[model samples]
Structure formats: structure tokens, C-alpha cells
Target: MSTIDRRTLLIATGALACVGSAHGHGEPKHPNTGAPVAKEQQPWGIAGEARRATRTVDLRMLDSMRFVPDRLAVKLGQTLRLRIRNTGAVLHELVIGTPAALDEHAALMLRFPDMQHDEPWMAHVPPGKTGEIVWTFNRAGEFAFACLIAGHYQAGMAGRISVRAA
Candidate 1:
């Protein structure tokens, strides 16, 4: 008889779920490596072309589980280039999505700490590294961005995006 420990079983289950499901922010990367999947429009906005970015915002993720300039405001129809620098000693990510979506995604991360997904609205950076995400806010509403790595979100590594009507 073979016995599978609870933790191992749970991790295996979580890995399968992450790879098989296309839920929340985006699809999981195959074998945890590759180019990100295609772009899609969320309620907050769609992936913006780099050429269309009207402004660039720089943010830093710290080991304290915080983002500098956590609050951002932009006009509708404007595209933004987010330049993210991870000053933390561990991996950090910036995933832009609706608040509800971000919450759900964060929960998933808690379950599968090794889960890896990629999207245009997301940037995963290692320690002392930088990444970028270009997004266009077509809808006028509130959005959010967070580091959904395990306990980061719960630690309040999040920020708000306000897209005002033009």
C-alpha cells in the first residue's frame, strides 16, 4: 500500500488545478515556463500597446510587502506603462485586475504557492530585478494591482487604480 502525505497531495492537487484552469487573471504557464497567453479585455481594461502608452509610472516593491505610490489615477482611454522594480529579497509580482478578481487570484496563490501564470497585465520580478506592464484603461472604474504571491496580498501588498472619465 502506498501512502501520500496530505501536504504532498494538496500540493499536487493545487498544481493540477493551476495548470488546468483558465480562471481569474490569466492562464497558467505551461510547466511554469514560456511566453504568456493571449490578451483579453477585462472590465478594468485591456492590454495596451507600448506605442500607445501616454504615461509611464514607476513603482518599487519592497520586502515590507508594499508598493511605493500605491495609489494611481488615470483618465479613461489613456494607456499607461508601469515600470516595476522589485527591491525585495524574494519574488514579487504585479497583477492588475478587478478587485474581486484579484481577491480570488490571491486565494488561489495561497493554495498553490508555486503556481505560475502570465498575462499582459502582470509582471513577475525576481529580487533586484525590473519588469513592465502596459495597460489601457478603457472603462471608467476602480481597479487594483497586487503581488499575489502566497501571503503577500494578505500582507497588504496592493494598490488602487482609479480610471476617471475623460
Candidate 2:
């Protein structure tokens, strides 16, 4: 899988926020490719390559701003299904990307807290609810997953992802 330019990703995410707000967050376009992820006719990004999960990771989001087992490990080329449960009494999200990208996105969410959309690498989980994000770790790198709900990130709601060799 190929990486998306940081600038391009940020621009796409910003556009997604704008379009999502205008469309009432009802499934706008995939920002990476400017098409619906449901269309199955386009590629979103490197993180968009979801396949049958070879591993299942169970994580818990806490109200105190923490992710249980915050540091996750996956082999390169391995597909995973992240099963996230919100044990918190509020909304939380899991967005996977580089630290810089996540930091930028967290700031964006702080500005537009109500903005919403579905992306291959994002999973929004409500209180007492569960969500899943299927993804393939194609590259070897240290990445991140975070909850970008307004003050959440500042409250220390984030995790590390280590994708190593196959």
C-alpha cells in the first residue's frame, strides 16, 4: 500500500468535514478518493485495504480518557479487525494514522466537534456501544490511534500502533 501525502490527507479531511456538515453527516464521499467507501469502486488510501481479519483486537475506551492495551502490535501485511467497546459514558472515536496527522485531526475536531463521516480508518463508538475497523497493515512503521472528540485527545485519549515485518 502507498502512503498518502500529509498535506493531501489534511485537505481531504478538511473537505470531508465541510461536506459532512453540509450533508448532515449522511455518508458523504471518501475524502482520500472523493468517492463513497461503499461504492467499492475506488481506493481511499493505504489504510483502506480491508480484508478478512486475521486477528481480532478487543479494546476498551474509558471515560477517564484511556484505551485499554493502548499499544497494539500487528505484522506487516496482516489484516486486523479492531473491536472497540466504549466503556465510557460518552462518545469516542478511533482514527488510525501518523502522529502528525492525528494531531492535526484532533485539532480540527476541537474546532468542529459536531462534524462526522465514515472512513475506512475511523470508527466512532458511542457509550456502551461497540464498533469495528477492518484494516491491513501493509507498511512497517509506528502509527497511532486516537479519540478526536473535542477535549478527549488533550485528556490523553490515544494509542500507539506498531506495524512490523511479516
Question: Which candidate wins on lDDT?
Answer: 1
Cα lDDT computed for each candidate against the true fold: 0.79, 0.73
Residue 51 local lDDT, model 1: 86
Q: Which stretches of candidate 2 lie over 4 Å from their true place?
A: 1-4, 17-51
Error of 2 at 47 (Å): 4.9
What's the CA error at residue 29 for candidate 2, in Å? 15
lDDT of 1 by residue, 28-63 (tens): 222434444355666778888888899999999999
Candidate 2 RMSD computed on C-alpha atoms after optimal superposition onto the true structure: 5.4
Candidate 2 lDDT by residue in tens digits, 1-166: 2355465565666768576333222232333444445422112225433456788899999999999989998887787888999898787888887787788777877788766656668787778978877777777888889988789899999999988886
